[model samples]
Target: MLPAPSSERWKPLRAGLVDMFYYDQEEFWFHDGRLLLRGNNGTGKSKVLALTLPFLLDGDLAPHRVEPDGDRQKRMEWNLLLGGKHPSPERLGYTWLEFGRRAADGSEEFRTIGCGLKAVAGRGIARHWFFITSQRPGAELRLLPDSRVPLTREKLREEIGSRGFVYDRAADYRRAVDEHLFGLGAHRYEALVNLLIQLRQPQLSKKPDEKLLSRALTEALPPLSPGLVTTVAEAFRGLDEERDALRSLADAQQAATDFLGHYRRYAKVAAKRKAAGPRLTQSRYEQLGRDLAAAEEAFTAAQQQLDEARGELTALEEQRAELEARRDALRADPAMRDAERLEQLRQDAERKEKAARDREDDRDRQASQVRKYDGRAGQAAHQAGTARDKLAEALREAADASADARCAQQHRTALA
Candidate 1:
């Protein structure tokens, strides 16, 4: 008897509502020997092909369970099968096919073949079947002449290459096909499939034969010039230095980008302060100068007035002394002892003397105040004037500096 076929399994790649796109369910199958699929247009035919891909690759289709609707007890079912020789004795060797149908109550019913194989092999020791599809009838099925064929990754690569197909990432390519063709209703999928078929056909290798070497020839090669070698090395070194510089520049640029976010806030505050500073300084300086000048003038006038009052007080004091002398003389006289005349003369003299002394004392106090006020006002005026001048000078300096900075900035921008 012929050796048993290799063990295999099928798992669902994708599944969806059959009634959504079409009135009937669509399905596909991939056997170890052939690929079989059937569906009408707009009936999720290509969708089934996409869904079944993982299953055909012998990968887990329903490795984890997912609840359907709110039913936590529901188990995720896969549309896959196992076929060929049994890997273990407890399981059957053939893959059984199944389909899902919608019930009247909006539930699904799974259908399956109880006995007959989904695909059959020819009656021979080297029997095998390869199921593929094509728009053309005869072109769909390809038969292997014998069972001596060995499949390998390199062989598959070569086969795919011959047919003008490339399987870099099978999953990605399948998704691209499904999305571009089936999902989007474009012809790109059909073109891709056809291209894959063309590429899968066998072809001869084009690599050159390495066995034909010339062993008889023996020759000495000339030495390279030291100068030329040094030049080349220097060039390489220069290139390496340039690459390092570029990497450093890139790092700096990234750091600058990060810092700019913080810098922007600081710059805004600084700009506002800078804009207000000059005008404020100028106004303060002008007001301070006016106040200083006014204070100084008032203090000088007070001092002059105090000096005139002092001179007037000195004259009054001299007059008071003369009157007191006269009163003493009158009191000492013999004739002054006469009652009415002596009393009237004494009273008149005392009154004049007291008035003169009082005027003198008031004038003296006023002079002292004038002196104190003059000193204080002069010092205050000097200080205030100095401060005003300094502030004005500072503002001018700042304005000049700002103008210079703007000019420098413009120059720099121009150069850049």
Candidate 2:
């Protein structure tokens, strides 16, 4: 059997104060495997951690020296070392770690170092790194090799495409450190861990294992004897025949069901038509008959009114003729020709003629008044007809407005 793979481990070093500068403390160390930090509240326990950023990133130690020159010219230089190896003053490895937060102010207080170191023994080195936080419940170990540098544009492209390979120089150096510390080789443990993490997290990348399902199903069945197989084959043939018969029955049942559904729909439509058709026809015929009868009655009433008007006109004319005849008879009487009596008779006749003329004028004035009243009645009737039309138009507009409001309400509901 193959031996179990070795797991990676990380060990913390010393961490505390080194010196002091203007507003900033010189140095602090928290590397006793127990991340101890000291200072008063707001006195740079966190600043110390920040100052140690270089050390954490490059695993180097540098003195916390202050600028002694007033001109800010030359000052004491801080020399740093990583894993006991002196780090170059120019460049250093980069540290990637999460920070803790200040309990009082809820501020983040952490640091990382950037430094690179070459092994004196001419062999590659692996670095180890981890995170410590007070805000979170527990510590977590970050398992990743130092990022590797690409040799060419094609390699860069490959690394970029793969996404599993480290692309940055600083990340590559850090990952190299981790690989050395964890005894990892060229294999992709980071990618595997990331894949496992993705699987553990709630993501949409999961796929069903159809092959595993098939295997499981096959495994659950018992081994088959030759006779048992033959018998099963025969049984399956018989079952096929039975299945065909059942299929035919099912098809027949389905057909019957479809026919019944169609028949029911047709019957419902037919019944509705049968019930509505005669009623609609009868209603139309009855309405037409009633309209015709009403029109006939209205015509008859109009004719009767016309006849009555004519009769009244004829009676008035007859009364006028009779009055004219009486006046003529009074004028032609023989007593009016006597001499003395003739003058009195003439005066009387003139008075009687004046009275008759006055009566005739009065009758003509009354007839004129009746004609004016009839004209006013016609105008009122026309005005009433116009008012009815206006009322109908207003009703139609109100109905349209109501319909529009209903439609708008329905549209709003649909959107909602």
Candidate 3:
């Protein structure tokens, strides 16, 4: 990731920050186990190193530990929220260091130590949690899920679930880091931190003081354990006998050295005379031995590969057979056939039900037509009855008119 630190074994491969300070995601690579920060004043060069180098290991977010100058005004919360510069009222961030070492066989082991900071505006640091994991960020792990999203404490815990531990207390975190990273006890780790702080003092480079420096160095050394002290005392009690044995061994070594110095001159001529005869044979033998070793190594590698391939083939064949058996069983199952038959029956029933509904609709339409015809027939009958009544009235009127006419004729003849 950042030009992979020098191939040389380095405990601290890189240090990084995610959503911490002015950095969204920033990684500082170490060259030959050292990192150099260069920038103008107030560029946070010191702050970056301070937050990562020893602070990540110390798990102390205190101002003194965070700022090299021990500035009391500088706070961890300010780094996260940027003292109101950030828009969010709350913030979460991480500062982590990746430690790695290469084994003799060229295999690599990594250990990561990080602290998650929760800062709330006006609330200082709301929470501080630390984690140590073997998972490497940007590789097996990612501290930020998105380009701009940092992991919260719970999210980090979930991500590192079972792979590592996240500690809420700084003491536990420090103890775990010391044990895992440095193999140091609490007192020794405290002394080492003190020494580091003293060495990192800004003024130490400007004005070197021999006496004060000596005193600080002395104070930083952890006291010897009682058991070690007792062992040393016991060793000294037998020192006189060891000294006599050492003197005798030294005398014998000197005599052998003297004898060998003379014997080398005689042996050198004899070896030159004799070695020429078997030189070619020895060379051929050595070459054959090397070739045999190479062949053996290749054979071993090929055998291992063959074994792996065979194992994979066997597993795949077994899986195929198992799948075939499952398929056959499913095909033979009576329940499956019954389910298919039931599905077909259901489809037929639905089709018949739909046909019945269509027939009912047709019948209802025909009934509506019959009702209309019956209403028309009733209106016609009413019209015919009215016409008959009119005709009867006209006939009665005609009869009455004829009678009136006869009466009028009689009256008229009399009036005439």
Among all windows of 10 consecutive residues in model 2, the one with the lowest summed lDDT is 134-143
**Weakest ten-residue segment in model 3 by summed lDDT:** 1-10
Which sequence of candidate numbers ranks them by TM-score, best first? Answer: 3, 1, 2
lDDT of 1 by residue, 109-215 (tens): 33221110111222111111111111111122111113422223243334323222223343444443343223422344444443332222222113333331111
lDDT tens readout by residue for model 3, 1-416: 11222334547888999998899899999886788889999999988978886788677788887788878899889988888999999999999999888756687878889999899998999988999887899977899886668888888888888778899998999888876777668887988887887677677667898887887687668788999999999899789779999999999999999999999998888656554434433344445445555545554554455455455545545655665575566557576568666576456545644554554454455445445544554544454455455544544443444343344344335325
TM-score of each: 0.28, 0.22, 0.51
Give per-residue lDDT, candidate 2, residue 156. 26
- Comparison by lDDT, 1 against 3, better one: 3
What is the Å distance of residue 341 in model 2 from its true position?
4.3
lDDT of every predicted structure (CA atoms): 0.41, 0.42, 0.74
Scored by TM-score, the top model is: 3
Top model number, lDDT: 3
lDDT of 2 by residue, 229-280 (tens): 9999999999999999999999999999999999999988865655454344
Model 3 CA deviation exceeding 4 Å by range: 1-10, 222-416
Sort by lDDT, top down from the best = 3, 2, 1
lDDT of 2 at 139: 29
lDDT agreement of model 2 with the native: 0.42
